[model samples]
Structure formats: structure tokens, C-alpha cells
Target chain A: MSIGIDELEDLAVGAAFLGTGGGGDPYIGRLIATKAIQDCGEPTVLDLDQVKDDDFVVTVAGYGAPTVQIEKLIGEGELEKALAKLEQHLKKKVTAIIPAEIGGSNSLVPIALASRCKLPVINADGMGRAFPELPMNVFSFNGISASPMIVTDEHCNTAIVETASDRTAEKITRAIAIELGLRVFIGCYPMTGRMVRECAIEGTLSQAIAIGRSIRQRPPGSCAIESLMHCLSTIYPDRESRVLFTGKIVDVQRDTADGFSKGSFRIEAFGSGQSAELIFQNEFLRVCVEDKLVAVVPDLICVVDEETASPITTGALRYGQRVKVIGIEAPPQLCSEQALTYVGPECFGMDFPYKSIATLEAEAADKAPKSATAV
Target chain B: MSIGIDELEDLAVGAAFLGTGGGGDPYIGRLIATKAIQDCGEPTVLDLDQVKDDDFVVTVAGYGAPTVQIEKLIGEGELEKALAKLEQHLKKKVTAIIPAEIGGSNSLVPIALASRCKLPVINADGMGRAFPELPMNVFSFNGISASPMIVTDEHCNTAIVETASDRTAEKITRAIAIELGLRVFIGCYPMTGRMVRECAIEGTLSQAIAIGRSIRQRPPGSCAIESLMHCLSTIYPDRESRVLFTGKIVDVQRDTADGFSKGSFRIEAFGSGQSAELIFQNEFLRVCVEDKLVAVVPDLICVVDEETASPITTGALRYGQRVKVIGIEAPPQLCSEQALTYVGPECFGMDFPYKSIATLEAEAADKAPKSATAV
Candidate 1:
């Protein structure tokens, strides 16, 4: 299927929502992807099942602190050049490009490269949502290595890292990212088509598009947010997706260090004393109301503009802005015990035990007053 | 000339003295070189003039904090593997190996790899004495690029860094070195034999061997330290090498950070109230006696056993130890206006202008009491 400008816009919107306040700014990515499509024809989007068993697939993404992107935008040609370097190192042509993670900008960056290179982009992605680190995905949990990875910066500097473990690869790449000014394009996690079929999150690109379509094409009399929530619940009944809170951002404390944008923000419910706090490392990992976690990683926690329902990424969060927080269950593969080790609360330095969004929400409901609090 | 275990040992000792208390521990490197010679054949040491201009010459050395080597040893196979990676990247065979810097362990590491790989070892080097960082070498000062550089750890992990400037290359390599636990082998400064002859400090290896010989093959009736000093003065008459001071170490302070061993030490005259202090960053760059400047980089400052002339490294310095400090004029190449910008006192954060050891020594002599005090 050829993805046109309309599909690209919808994909960006849905990716921003799914990004849960990390990834990168959608506007910048949409512009770049849009330009690529116009200049070099629409990108071919292929389903996971369409790729042959023997085909080679490579995941492409930007790796660095998102805060750095606010001032230093992703420039043209870095992604294409980095992918070319990876191809040269492997001595093989890539069968298709796959997003390492689905995010506002990240989901489309690969597609832009695919358009220019005239390669197909797989509908699948490693992480259904954006993640801060490379190894926190199903591919790593399923024993796939992240090595033989190439990282490149705008200055044309390239570093090829090959190591034994995904953890080491992440470390080496992060070190390079810090030295290279915290913005880099990585061509990594080289895998076979069979591996992608077996381990990747399927149809993420299409799912993002569907979620975005609901927000854009709400019924004339119906509220856009209601339509979006309805669309999300209908699409992810198993995920138990829902709006958890609507409030004004009260405070935020963020700082970039060691190539990571890490901090937390507080929000107070409208006309209520109740509040929620969300702590993040690139992507929002934990959201709590009254010291009780309503959502936690690898579950999804997202912030969207209250009235318009457009996604607001972690980097764009501002004090006194009205927003709504949403929570959705993680994919089944990522919810496994083995997968949790890579994205669990403990993995992010939180000592709390793992609790599904369902269990946590039900517990919070049980503690609230009969009328149900706004937060 | 075939470098036997005896010559290797002498080279290590002399390199340690020239290491200016940085480089790495000589005993560790000497043992490794000795074993390599026994396993393979003797390393063929060739003069700088022996090779043709088109021959491919690569410098091989370890890059990281020398203090780290004291606890974690330099293992086997890393250099050979890293060198092979570099060769594969360039798609050409390395015709010869040269020391990136001449120091206790660094000067001998390339020779050891040369013995095993059956490649001739260049008698010359980039830095006649060691400095903490890569760009501080004459090779970089002479417009040599340090990129297309490959760094490898004992874990078999390799990183290839390519950039426009040697300074950026050093920063990237150092970042990786910190992540790799501060002990890494690097195959960098890829240049032709013509570049080596044009820019390299010629005969550094042979000069180190000679300095070691004076300490070992001293005239029966003469003091070993005296013989060593006489040998140094003869070898670098333009440098005017001499013993600068003799005293007990009264105080010392050091710490390892960002892949460098940096600190200062104080020495008190045996019976007099006068004292001297030397500051270093992996290498001793400056020394002051009676609050008067005595030596500074790009000059050479060394610490040796007061009676035996065995070089003592910065990592091995201890309070209350008796020692003699030696200072030698820097090579003419490094003393030039452009070269000083790379290794001058200001490069290491010293604000004082760089003054030659000859001038500083003459000034100190003029201020001294007639008949001269021991300090």
C-alpha cells in the first residue's frame, strides 16, 4: 500500500498520542516526511506478512535526549547517510525499513528515508510506543542482539558499534551521543523477516493511522475527544484504554543529563484539590494520583490537549496548560514476565511492584468517593 | 634490528622515564612485550628512513586512564583484533606499526603486537614523551587526522570513529574509553610512511632504549644516575637534559576522572626549608622550585629513583619517597608556534606562558646560593 500525505499526517498524530510524551515533535517530522513524499513519490508500506522469510530488515530511529531537538532540529540527509553506512557495513541491501519504536516523529523518520531510498517500510515496529533506551523492546527480550549498530551525527561523523549485549550497545551509543551533541540517527537491530514476524508488534503504523483518523473525522455534532476515546477503546478492548484524568499542569521539573531528559510533572484536576504526578525518562513511565499509580511502564501514559485532543509530548509540557492523561495496556508480548525486566517499574529505578493498568485503575476506583473524583 | 627481550625491557624503562609519569606502568608492558617476543619472533625495529613513502603505517597504543591499568591488566588479543578491524575498514594491509606515544607501557604495546603480527615496528613515534590526550602529539600538530580510528576493549567490542578534526576524534574516543572501563586499544592516526617521516619524532624508541641502556650498562665506577644523565644530555644536547632536583616527596594528591590521571606533588629539600611542586595530567607538565618555574611542557619532566635511575610513574608515586626530578627540552617540532597550541601549558589549563627548560634552569641557577644547595 502506498502511504500518501493524508496517511502520513494521520500516522504522525496517532504516533504522538502513542508516544506518551516523548519520542520527538510531530510537526518537524511531518514536514520532513511530507517533503520526502512530494519529492520522491509516496512510500510503499508493506505488511509484516508480505516480507519473505529470508529477507533482511533493519530498524531505523533517532537516539538521543529529546530536549536537544528543541534547539537543534533533525537535519536532512543524516538518516539516509546513516542507513547507507549500515548497509555498507553489512554488505547487503535492506529489504525494508522498520521503525525501532512508534513515536510522533520516530514513526515517520524511517518512512521518510524509505521514500527517498525507494524501499518499502514495514507496518511493524519493535516498540508499539516510544521508549528511551534501545534494549527495552520485545526484540531484546526475545534474544535479538542490537549490535552491529551504526550511529551518525549531522557533522557526518559515524561510529559503528558491535558488542555482545544490547545493554552494552546502548551504553556505547549513549556515550557517543553525548560526545556528538546528543542528537544522532541510528541504523540498528538488524534482523531477518522471519524474526520480525515472530517478535515485532504488528500493524503499529496502521493502528496509529486509525487512531488519528478518529480525531480528524469526528461526527459533526460529536466531540472529537469522545470520538477518539471511543475509537481507542474499540480498537484496544484488550488494552483497557481510557482517559484517566483532566487537569491543568501545575509544575514541571526537567533537566537533561547523560543524554537523557529526565524529570516529573504535577497536574491539578479542574475545580478540585486532587492532583496527579507523572515521572518520565523521555517517555512517561509512571502516573500517580494521591500516591497511587494509575499507570506504569510498559503500559502507556499519554498527555493530550484537553479540548482539541491533540497529543502533547513530554518536551512540550508547560505550566498551567489544560491536558488529559490517558492509559493503555502494553502489548501481550511486552507484558510477559521476561519483557517486564526490560521496562518494569524496577527497571526505571522505581521500587514498586508491577501492576497492570486494569488492576491499578480498579483499585483507585475502589478508594474514590461514590460520585467519582475528577482526577 | 631485531628487538629481543633485553631491548624490550630497556625500552620500557626509558619510555617510563620519558612517560613523564603518565604513559602506563612499564613493568606490565615490558612483561607483555617479553612474552610476545618469546611466542612469536623478535619484533623487527626499523628506522624511519627504511620504509618507502607509499607504505601504510598505523600507530597502535592503549588509550585511557593509566591508573586503571594498575588494577585491571591489559589482556592479550585486543590490539591484534582492533588492528585487523582498522585494516578491514581501510581495505588495505598495514605495512608497519608505530607507537602513538612513547611511555612506560604505551611505547612497548605496539612492538608486542608487531612481534605477533610479523610487522616491522617503527623506531620513531608521534609523541617523544607521553601526554594525557591524543591530539597533544606532533602527528596531530602536523595536520595528521586521527580518525578512521578504531577502538576496542577486552570484551571484543569495537568502535570506529571518523571525524573532521583530531580534537573531536579524541573526545569521542575518550567517551568510549570511559564506557569501556578505561582500558582500550586504539589503532589510529592512519598515515603513509611519508607522513610518518615528515611529522613523527624520529628515533623515540631507539632513544628510549639508549636511555635504558645507560641505567643498565653504567660504567662500573660511576653512579648509574650520573651515567643516565650524561647519556640523556648527549642524546639531546639541544634539549640540555639534566637532573633538576633531589629530595623526598613531602606530599602528593591524585585522582582519576574522564579517562585521565591528574594531580600534583610536592617535594621538600632533605635538610633545607626549600620545596618544589610538580603538576601533571597523566604526564608531569610543570615543576616549580622555591615558587620559581623550573620546567614546563612541551618539555619533559621525569621522576626516577635517586640512586638507581629507574623511572617511577605518576600512579606509583608515594609520599616520603626519595627521588630525583629530571627535565629535558621538548623536541624542536613540538616547540614551534603551532605545535605549542596543542601541548603547551595553556592546553592543560595552566595560565602561565610556556618557557623553555634551558631558560628556566638558567634563571634558577642564577637565583641559587653560591656553591649550590642540594635541592
Candidate 2:
């Protein structure tokens, strides 16, 4: 299937929903991808089954502070430059492009470059949802090397990192990004089609498009929260999707530290004394109501505009904005023991044990407090 | 010519003096070079005149914080691994290895690697005296690109930086160094033999060896300060060398901040009402008597043990130690208008105009009270 300019808009909306307040703002990415599709022809996007076993696949993503992305926008051709450099280092032609994460800017970066380079993009991604760290991707958790990664900036400066560990590569890449204007294009995880099929979160691109289309097709006067939850449930039948809270943003405390936008926000329920708080480092990692855990990653904690169902990124969050908090079960692959070791709440220095959204909700219902179980 | 174990010691001693308190303590480098020579046979040492114009040359040095180098020593074969990677990138045999800076550890790093890699050691360096930043090197000032620079650490991780400017390269390399244990082996400024001959500070290896030999040849009870002065004058006849002050270190205030050891030391004249203070960042940059600027970079301010004339790096400074402050004129190349734009005192944030050591001493002589002239 070809991804045209119209498809890019849908992809952006879907990516923002999946981003869960990370992955960076997608507005610029959508514009860039739209322009790229217009300048070049629509890019071919191949299903996982269509990829040859021997084909070489690479993942492309934007790495930097989301706050910085709003102002220091990437110029056209930057992603292509990064991909070209990676191909040169690998000494092989890249048969296809893939998103490192299915969120915000990262989701569209691959399509933008693939269109310009006339390469097909794989209809899959390393992360089913947005993640703040490189290692949080399935490719890294499944033993794919992040090495021979090429990072390029708008100024045409490039750096190739070959590290012994994925974590080290992330560290070095983040440091370089900070040095090069706080944002860079990264092409990494060069895997064979077989490896991609084995480890990738398959069909995330189509799923995102479906989600975007569903949200857009909602009728006027329909409850956005109910429509989005129904859309998510229809698309991901095996996973639980629910609106965890509905409130107005009361407070947002943020600081850009250690190359990450880290902060917490509080939401106060309308006509009720109840309030919820979400803490994040790039992506929303945890949400609690009255100091009791309601949802935690790798489960999704999505904040969206109540009226329009448009996702709001962490960088875009502000006080007094009415929003709905939605929680979706993460893919089983992400919740695996090995994956949780790196992506779990412990990784973020939280002492609380990880429990699924369903389990937390079940316990809340069993407690026999009507107001507490209202979510 | 070949550099043996004996020559390695001399090189280390001389390099320490030339380090002006920055290149990190050479004790470990000397030990490593000595062991490498014993195992691999002495490496060939080639003079600039001996190199053919077409021969490929690369500079190798250790980039890191001096305080860290004392404890987190490199494992064997690290430098060789870095050079091998660089050669692989350049797709050509490195005819000779040169020091990026003629500083304590950096000066010997090339020789140590050359001994094992079977490459000739070039009798030259990019920096005649160690400076804090990579752009302060003569090669950079003379328009050599510091691109495709490879940085490797003990863990075998390597990063290749191709930048549009040398300053960017330095910023990225330094950032990577911080990520990779605050110390790394950097192979940069790949050039032809002709480029080295045109831009490199030639004969620095031989000059260091000569200085080392002279310091060693001093009689046990002879006046070390006077003898060292005579040795320097005899060696660098065109340059001015003098003891700037003779006093006891009264105070030392230092802090390791931003990957640099920065602070100042105060010295009180022996049995007199006189004192001087020297400020440094890795390398000593300025010296003042009662807040009056006496000597400043790109000139050299060296502090050595009063009794033995052993050079003390900024990291090893302590209070109440008897010491002598010596000033030497920087090479004319480094003092050139273009070179001074980045390496001069003002570049270090000092507002004062740069004046050569000779000029500073001349002004002091003209304004001298009888006691002040004693220096």
C-alpha cells in the first residue's frame, strides 16, 4: 500500500494517541511528511508478510528533548542524510524503513524519509507505543544491536556509534544529541527481515491508522471519550481499554533534566473532590488517584482533549485544560519478563510493584467504595 | 630511530613539564609504554623530514578529565584497538602515529600504541603544550579538519565523528568521553605527511627527550631551578625561560567541575612579604602577583617541586609545599593572531589582552621595586 499525504495526517493523529505524552509533538512531523509525499511520490508500505527473509530493514527515529523539537525543527532531507550514512556504514542497501517507536514524530520520520528515498516502509515498529529510551524498544530487548547507528543533524554533521550494549549506545546518542542542538535523526537497529518478523510489534502502523480514522469518523455530539475507548477496543480486541479519569489539569511541574522532560501533573475531577496525578519522564509512566496506583507502564497512560479526543503530549500539557485519561493494556511482548526488567517501574526508581490496569481496577471495585471505583 | 624503555621514561618526564599541569599524570602512560616496548620491541621514530609527502598520518591521544585518569586506568590493547578501527575507517595503513598534544599522557599514548601496532612514531604533535580544548591544537588553527575522529574506550565501544567544524567535533568527543567513563582514546586529525609537516609542531618529541635528558643529568645537589633554566635556554635558544617566582604554596582551592579541574593556588615568597597566585583549568592559564597579571596563556605557567624540580600537575597540587613558578614563551605559531583567537587568555574568559612572556617580564622589569625584580 502507498502512504500518501492524506495517510500521513491519519498517521500523525494515531501516533499522537500512541505517544502517551512522549515521542515528541507530531505537528511538525506531519507537515514534513506531507511535504515529502508531495515532493516525491507516495511511499510504498509493505506488510510484514511481504518482506523477504533476507531483506535488510532499518529503523529511523528522532532522538532528543520533546520541548526542543517544538522550536529546533528538522530541515528537509535530514532523515535521508541519516539513512544514507547508515547504509554506507553497513555497506549494504536498506531494503525497507521502519519506525523505532509508533508515536508522535518517530512514527512519521520513517515515512518521510522512505518517500524521499523511494524505499518501502515496513508496516510495523519496534515499540507498540512511545518510549523515552532506546532500550525500551522491542528490538533492543530481543537482542538486536543498536550499533553502527548513524545520527545526523540539520547542519549535516553525522556520528556513527558502535557500542557493546544498547544502553551505552543510547547514552552516547543522547549525549551527542545534546551537543548537536538537542535533537537529531537516528538510523539504527539494522535487522534482517526474519529478525524483524520475529521481534517487531507487528501491524502497529495499520493499527495506528485505524485508530486515527475511527477518531476522525466520530459523529458530532458523540462523546469523544466513549468513541475513542470503543475504537481502541474494536482495534485491539485482546487488550483492555478504558477511560481512567475525566478532569481538568490543575498543576504541571516540569523540568528538562538529564536530556529528558521530567515532570508530574495533577488533574482535579469536575464536581468532585477527587484528583489524579501522573508522573512522567518523556512519556507518562504512572497515574494514581488519591495516592493509590491506578495504572503503570508498560500499560498506556494517554491524556487527550475531552472535546476532540486529540492526544496531548507532555510538552503541550498546560494548566486548566479539560482532558480524559485513558489506559490501554500493553502488548504481551512488551510485558514479558525480560522487557519489564528494563521498562518496568523499577527502572524509573519507583518502589511500587507493577500491576496491570485490570488488576488495579478489580481491586478498586472489590474495596466497595463507590467514588473510589468510579473510574 | 627506535624509542626504548629508557627513552619512554625521559619522554614522560619531559611531557609532564610540557603538560603545564593538564595532559594527566604520565606515570601510568610511561609504565604502559615501557611494557609495550619490552613486549613488542622498540617502535620506529621518524622525523618530519624522513616522512614522504604521501604517507598517511594520524594523531592519537587520551581525552578525559585528569582526576579520573589517575584511578580508572586503561586496559592493555585499548589504544591498538582504537588505531585499528581508525585504519579500517580510513581504509589505509597508518604510516605513522603522532601525539595530538605533547602533554603528560597524550605524548606517550601514540608511542605506546605505535610500539604494538608496528607503526612509526612521528616526531611531532598538534599541540606544543597541552590546552584544555581540542580546537586549541595547532592543526585546527592551521585549517586541518578533525573529522572521522574515532573515540574508543576500555570496553571496546567506539564512535566515529564526522563534523562540519572542529569545535563541534570537540564538543561531541568530550560528551562521549563523559558517557564512556570520563576517559577515552581518540584518534583524530588524519592527515598526509605533507599536512603534518606544514602544520604540526615538529621536533617536539626530540625536544621533550632533550629536556628530559637535561633534567636527569642535573647533579644531585646542584641548584635545580638554575640548572633547569640553563637546560631550557640551551635547548630552546630562541625562546625566553625564567623562574617567575620562588615561594611556598600557601593555599590551593580546586574543584572538578564540568569535566575540568579548575581553581587557583597562592604562593608566598620565602622569608619575604611577597606572594603570587596562579589560576588553572586543567592547565595553568594565568599567574598574578597581588592581582596583577604577570603570565597568561597561550604562554606556559609551570609549577614544580622546589627541591627536586619535578613538575606537579594541577590535580596534584597541595598547600604548604615549597615550589617554583616558571614561565616560558609559547611557540610563535601558537602566538600568531589566528591561533591566539581561540587559545589566548581571552578565550578562557579573561578580558586582558595577550602579551608574550617576554613582554610581560619586560613590563615587570621596568616597573620593578628591588624586591619585585628579584624574580
Candidate 3:
């Protein structure tokens, strides 16, 4: 299946939801990706099973803090140059572009590069949800090296990181991005088609597009939030979703430091004696109600505008804005004992242990009074 | 002339004197360079006129704070790897190695690599004396791009910086060096034989070796310092050398910041109660006696032990140590108006005006009382 320019908005919206309140605002990405399609024709997106074992897959996305990203959007030829450099280093043609993470701008960057290069995009991604760091992905969890990676600034100043571990690669690339003003494009994690099938979280592109469509459908009398939850369960029966908080943002704090947007925000329930707080580092890492952890990393914590049900990235959150926070369970692979070591609550330095959104919500329901509700 | 295992000491000693008060300690470099010559046999040395117009000349050196470099030495294979990566990027064979700067470690790195790769080392250098930053080189002074350069750590985590201005290349590499523990090897300033012949400071290697020998000769009835100054005049009548002060180090301060050993040290004359202050970032930038400027950057401000007459690097300075501060005029090209724009005192953020070492010494001589001797 290929993504036409018309469906780009739907994809962006869905990607924003899965971005977990990070991945940057997708409006600019949508514009660039749409223009790329018009200039070079819609790109073909391939399913994981469609690629042969010998095919070479490359990952492309922006690497930097989300706050800095929106201020200085990707410039012309940055993507083309990075792709060319990556191919030159690999000494072979890239078969397709895979979104390193299925989140707003990260997803769109690959599609845009794909259209410009006349290449296909893999339907799956390294992480089903967005992560702030490079190694916080399934590819790293699967022991893939992130080297031989090509990074490019808007002015075409490029560097090729070769033969570094994923951890050192992250530090090197992050320091570079910070030195280059906190935003640069990277084409990393060169993998085989077989590795893609074995390590990637499948159907993320399609799933993101469908999630975008469900929120926009807005059936009469059916709350968009309720419909979005229904859509999640409909797509993945094993996964669960819940409305963690419905409130107005009271205090939102952010500081761009060490190549990340770090801070937390407080939310007060509308016309109710309940409140919640969400902590984030580029992506929302944890959501807590009355100091009790409700949803943590490796799970989605999507913040949406209350009336329009439009996804709001972490950078777009504002004080006094009415919003709904949704917690969706991650795929089983991301929550496994092995995977948790890389993306779990502890990996993010949270004091508490990792708990499934479903389990946390069930525990809350059991503790609450029969007729009363608590945030 | 090819440098054999025997002349390595003379070369290091001379390079250290030319390095001013920085360029790191040469003890370790001497040890490693001696082993390289023994392992690979003697390497050929090429004069400026030796290389053809089409020959490719690559510059190699270590880049970081001098204080950090000595603590964690360069491991085996680091040089070989950087050279291989650089050559691969050029897609052409490097005909010879050129010292980017003729200073302690910087000068020896080339000889070691030349032996390892069976290549000749150019007898000239980018800077006749070491300057802290990349843009301070004559290659950059001649408008050569510092890109297509390869940098590597001891662990072989390599990155190739290509297509950036020398200034930007410095920032990128510096940030990476800091992130990688403040020391890394770089192969940069890829130039043609024509460029090297036109832009390089010629014969600095042979001069360094001669200076090294003059200091070691220590002729009886005449001070070694006196003999060293005589050697300087004999080699280049166009240049002048003066002992700025003979003192005991009173206060030494240093802070490794922004990938540089930055600080100022004060020295007091042995019995005259006179004092001098030398300010440095990596190499000595300025020397002042009684708060009056005596010498500024783009000139050599070498510090040596009073007893041994051996050059002491900036990192080796200690309180209460008796030393002789010598000021030597830089090569003619380095003092030219065009060259000063890149390495003048103003470039180091000092407010003093540019004056030759001879001019500063003459001014100090005119200011002192007829029978009074001051530091």
C-alpha cells in the first residue's frame, strides 16, 4: 500500500496520537511531506512480509529535542543529502525507508524522503511509539548497531558515524545535534529485510493512519475520545485503552537541556476535585493521578484537545487549555522483560516499577467507592 | 632527510620548545614514536619542494585539551584507523603525512603514522608553532576546507566530518571530543602538493630537531639558555629570541573547560621582586611583566626549567619551580598581516595590539631604568 498526499494529514494525526505527546507538532511535517508527494509522486509503502531477506532497509528521521525542532523546521535538500550520504557510506542502494519510530515528524520525514528518492517506505517502525533517545527502540533491544549512520544539517554539513554501539551512537549523535543547534536529520540502523520482519513493530503506519481517521470521523453523539478508545481495541484486541484524565492544564513547565525537552505539567479536572500530573522528556514518560502512577513509559499517553479531539504534541501544550489524556497499552514485545530493560519506567529513571495501563486502571477501579470517582 | 630512531628525541625537544608553554608534555610521545620507528623501520622525510603539484597531502594530529591528552593516551590502531578512513573518504591515496602543527605530540603523531603506513612525512607544517584551534592553521589561512576529515577515539568509534567550514568543523569536533572524554585523533586539512608548498611553514621539523640538539648540548662555561638563543639566531637571522624573565612560578591556575586548558599563571623573579604573568588557553597567548605587555600571540612564549634548560609544557607547570620564559619571533608568514587575522591576540579575546616578539622586547628594554633590572 502507498500513502497518497491526501492521506498524509490522516497519517500525521494518527502519528501524533502514538507519539505520546512528543515527536514534535506534525503540521510542518505534513506540509513538507505533501509537497514532496506532489513533486515526486506518492511513495510506495511496503508490508514487512513483502521485502526479501536480501533487501536493505534504512531508517530516516529528525533527531533532536521537540521544542527546538518546531522553531527551525527541516530545510530543503537536508533529507536528500542525508539519504545520499547514507547510501554512499553503505556502498549499496537503499531498498526502502523505515520510520525509526511511528510518531508525528519521525514518520513523515521518512515518507517525505521516500517520495523524493522514489523509494518505498516500510509499513512497520523500530518502535511502535515515539522515544526521546535513539537506543530506546526495538532494534536496539534486538542487539542492532546504530553505526554507519549518516547525519546532515540543513546546510549540507554532514557526518557519518561508523562502528559505534547504539549507546555511544546516541551520545555522539545527541551531542552533535546539540552542537548543530539541536536539530539534525539521521539515516541510521541499516538493517536487512529479514531483520525488519523479526524486530520491527508491524503495521504501525497503517495503524497510525487508522487511528487518525477514527478521531476525525466524529460520529454524532459518540465522544471522539470514546471512539478513539474503541478504535484501539478494534485494531489490537490484546491491547487496552482508558481515559486517564479530563482536565485543564494549570501549570506547564519546560526546559530544553542536554538535547532534551525536560519538565512536567499539572492538570486540574474541570468542575471536579481531582487532578493529575504528567512528566516528560521530549515524550510523556509518566502520568500520575494524586501522586499515584497511572501510566508510564512503554505505553502511550496521548494528550488531545477536549472539543476537537485533535492530538496535541508536548510542544503544543498550553496553560488553561482543556484536554483529555488517554493511556493506551503498548504491544507485548515492548513490555516484555527483555524490552523493558531498555524502555521501561526504570530505564527512564522513574522510582516506581513498570505497570501495565490496564493493570493500573483495574487497581484504581477496585479501590474507588462504588458511586464516587477519584483522579 | 629521513628521521631515524636516534633523532626522535631532538625532534620532540625542538617541537616542545616551538609549542610555547602548551602542546602537551613530550615524554610519552617520544616513547611511542621511538617504538613506531623500531617496528616499521625509518620513515622518509620530504621537503616542501619534494612533493609534486598533484600529490595529496593529509594532516594528522591529536586534538583536545593538553591536560586531558596525557592522562588517557592514544591506543594502538587509532592512528591507522583514522588514516584509513580519511583515505577512503578521499578515494585517493595519501602520498605523504604532514604535521598540522609542529608541536610536541602533534609533530610526533605524523612520524608514527608515516612509519605505520610506510609514507614520508613533509618537513614543513600547517603552523610553525601550535595554535589551539583548527582555524588558526595556515591551511585555513589559505582558505582550504577542513572537511572530509576523519576523527577517531581509542575505542575506534569513528566519525567523518565532511563539508563544513574549518570553524564549524572545530566546533563539531570539539563537542565530540568533550563527549568522548576530551581527547580524539583527527586527520584533516587534505591539500594538494601545490597547496602545501604555497601555504605551509617550511623546514620547521629540521629547525625543531636543531633546537632540540642545541638545548641538549649544554656547552660548559656558557649557559644552555645562552647556547639555545645563539642557535636560534644562527639558524634564522631574520628571527630573534629573548629571555623575558627568570623566575620561580608563584601561582598556577588551570581549568579544563570547553575542550581547552584555560588559565593564567604568575611568575616572580628570583630576587628582584619583579613579576610576569602568562595567559594561555592551550598554548601561551600573551606574556606581561609588571602588568605591561611584553609578548603576544603568533609568537613563541616557551617556558623552560632553569636547571635542566628543558622545555616545560603548560600542563607541567608547578608552584615554586624556577623557570626561564623565552620569547621567540614567529616565522615571517605567521607575523604577516593576513596571518594575524586568524591567530592574532584579538582572536584569543585579548585586547592587546599585535607586535612582533622583537618589538615587544625592544619596548621593554626602553622602559627599564639604565641600571635597574626588572622581570
lDDT score for residue B146 of model 1: 88
* Model number 1 iRMSD: 0.8
Once fitted onto the true fold, the runs of candidate 3 whose alpha carbons sit more than 4 angstroms away are A363-375, B364-375
Per-residue C-alpha lDDT of model 2 across residues A269-353, encoded as one tens digit per residue = 9998899999999999999998889999999889999888989999999999999999999898888889998788888889876
Least accurate 10 contiguous residues by lDDT in model 2 chain A: A217-226
Which pairs of residues collide in candidate 2?
none
Clash count for candidate 3 is 0
Candidate 3 chain A: worst 10 consecutive residues by lDDT? A366-375
Q: Score every model by TM-score.
A: 0.97, 0.97, 0.97
Question: Which CAPRI level is candidate 1?
Answer: high
Interface RMSD (Å), every candidate: 0.8, 0.7, 1.3
Ranking by DockQ: 2, 1, 3
As a whole number from 0 to 100, the lDDT of residue A343 in candidate 1 is: 85
Listed for each candidate, the true contacts retained, as a fraction, are: 0.85, 0.94, 0.87
Per-prediction DockQ scores?
0.85, 0.89, 0.76
